[model samples]
Target: MDKERLYDELRIFKDRHFLQQKLKSPLTVYVLLALSYLLITILFAVALSRVSVLSSQLNEMRKELKRNHSSEDFKLFPCGPEAREWEYFSGKCYYFSLRMTSWQRAKVLCEEKHSHLAIVNSHAKQNFIMYRTRDKRFWIGLSDQNAEGVWKWIDGSDSTTGFTYWKEGEPNDSNQNEDCAHVWTYGEWNDVHCTYECYYICEKPAPL
Candidate 1:
């Protein structure tokens, strides 16, 4: 009887289980969205921080480059061995002839040296050449050899467009054959007969 009572006490009368609660609607989505948003925010902050660092480094490099090259001549002419026997200005090399010759002969001489007559394109170049001229007349490479009154450089650049330093009542093509351009004593320009003997200027490309 005691054994039967012990068995009855140890036996379970009904099946038993702990209940599990289901997550509520919308709460699951809210939690997932919060996690996703946090992950994306962290990634964006990392990318932005890296970009800022790179930008700062590039700016510093640019400043250093400018500082290093600051003393260098901004003129593209390298003024080195390859540009020997020439003077540099802006980005071109100029050669002033000590001898006087006809405009056509001057052009021939310049072409022989693999260059053309000086083509002044800027006020600075005009001033520089004038200072070197010392009040003497010099021939440039401008002409209307192709068409009357339609002036052009020997290199075929249109001269009607920019920075002309013509003298008063000049380039009148005085004899209807005045086609070549020359600089006067005070840096003014005039068109004269190609046969006129005058000092010439030559120009060529600067080095690489």
Candidate 2:
């Protein structure tokens, strides 16, 4: 009877151990599934946050574009004798020359016409210049000739203190000689030698 009782106790312990092992596997699987769900939820939340921020930025950009396009300052006005040969915008007259010349000569020519080489200070003006100078390289009124890396507009204004739109990796002063600034047809600035010949744009204030 003692041997039979000992065998019954052994069977009970084996059944309990098997039950514990089965419970442990299911618990481990539940823990793993819970962690995976948590990770997926966090990732989805982050993605949603990024999408929201991007949507807001896109809306702001659209508003800005609309404002720029609808402003009367962006309109072209060619009125009176002073503006006959020039395109007027935002109280300024611009002359896009067809002849190519050295930067120095171009500056002198503009001055002779009672104007100066173009000094771009705003995006709207830059766009207008680009539209008028389509597919042509033109010299603007910017240079670092007086001091390397210290660009200044022809009006003696500091170029670093205001708006500037330089092409990527430009104004590199290639061969240690490039000092004059010119605009590409695509509306970005680059530095080249002042002696290099190119067409130019002139800017002057419109008469009140």
CA deviation > 4 Å runs, candidate 1: 1-84
Tens digits of lDDT, candidate 2, 23-108 = 68978779879999999999999999999999999999999987765453434443344356787878888888989999999999
Q: Which candidate is the best by TM-score?
A: 2
Per-candidate Cα lDDT values, in order, are 0.84, 0.87
User: Which tens-of-lDDT digit does each residue in 66-179 have in candidate 1?
Assistant: 855643533433554445567788778888998999999999999998889999989999999999887788999999989999999988999989889989997798788999
Number of colliding residue pairs in model 1: 0
Q: TM-scores across all candidates?
A: 0.60, 0.61
